[model samples]
Target: MKLLMMAACAGLTLNTAAAQEMSYGHAEYLNSCAVCHGVDGTGDGPLRDLLIRRPADLTQLSERNGGTFPYSRVFATIDGRYAVPSHGNREMPVWGRLFLEDDAKNYGPSGGEVVTTERIHNLAGYIETLQH
Candidate 1:
């Protein structure tokens, strides 16, 4: 009985870890970015109607960049390190800040920067998968 309980707990831990890792970037994109970029990364999100400048069609990032995904640029853009002219004073939420806040809640305040960077990388990598 004890062995069975231990096995069950181990299974639960593995499942939870896998789910968290798999959903990390996708969840961030959906919660923060899909409002502008759309679930399909087509930039036709519901908020598009409210914006003066249309949200960029994220699927075309590679095409717009000579058929190569600009990974660093995308990461910087998300982290607010690279300013996007159309975004206007970075009105869109700075995800780095939000991630740091979230990390502080989960992992405490000391290593928030590392958490923020990992979040940016996860988000940027997810966007790369959206490229056409």
Candidate 2:
């Protein structure tokens, strides 16, 4: 997790928008999930109107799961191992597979898997913090 946070910070540049105002996970969320889940995880991003089904209200994840954040499920969801209908076929997660491929190049096989898992864990932790 620390390694991933360092990597996230290393990728940031002085020209980035409101960099200091955002935490690493928040920045990650904005770069990825926020496009479909919204800044507050309310399922009302710009693409909401264009999709066949509404994105889940991420903030309600805990509420919907007996007041406990479904950590492993969320981790699996982000990792693309879980079958999310909106994300399309499990065999090919167009979005996440791209990241996996890129990570494989940047970090190699074992390292990339480690990095990817850490990223998923970090992102899941961030989502847990957002539960209301």
Model 1 scores what on Cα lDDT? 0.85
TM-scores of all predicted structures: 0.74, 0.75
RMSD after Cα superposition, model 2: 9.3
Off by over 4 Å in 1: 1-23, 81-88
Model 2, 1-132: lDDT tens digits are 999988788677543656786776787788888877898999988877777778789999999999999998887777775465786554213445656777889999888777777766778888898988
- Assess candidate 2 and give its lDDT: 0.76
Show where candidate 2 strays beyond 4 Å: 1-18, 82-96
Supply the TM-score for candidate 1.
Answer: 0.74
CA lDDT of every candidate: 0.85, 0.76
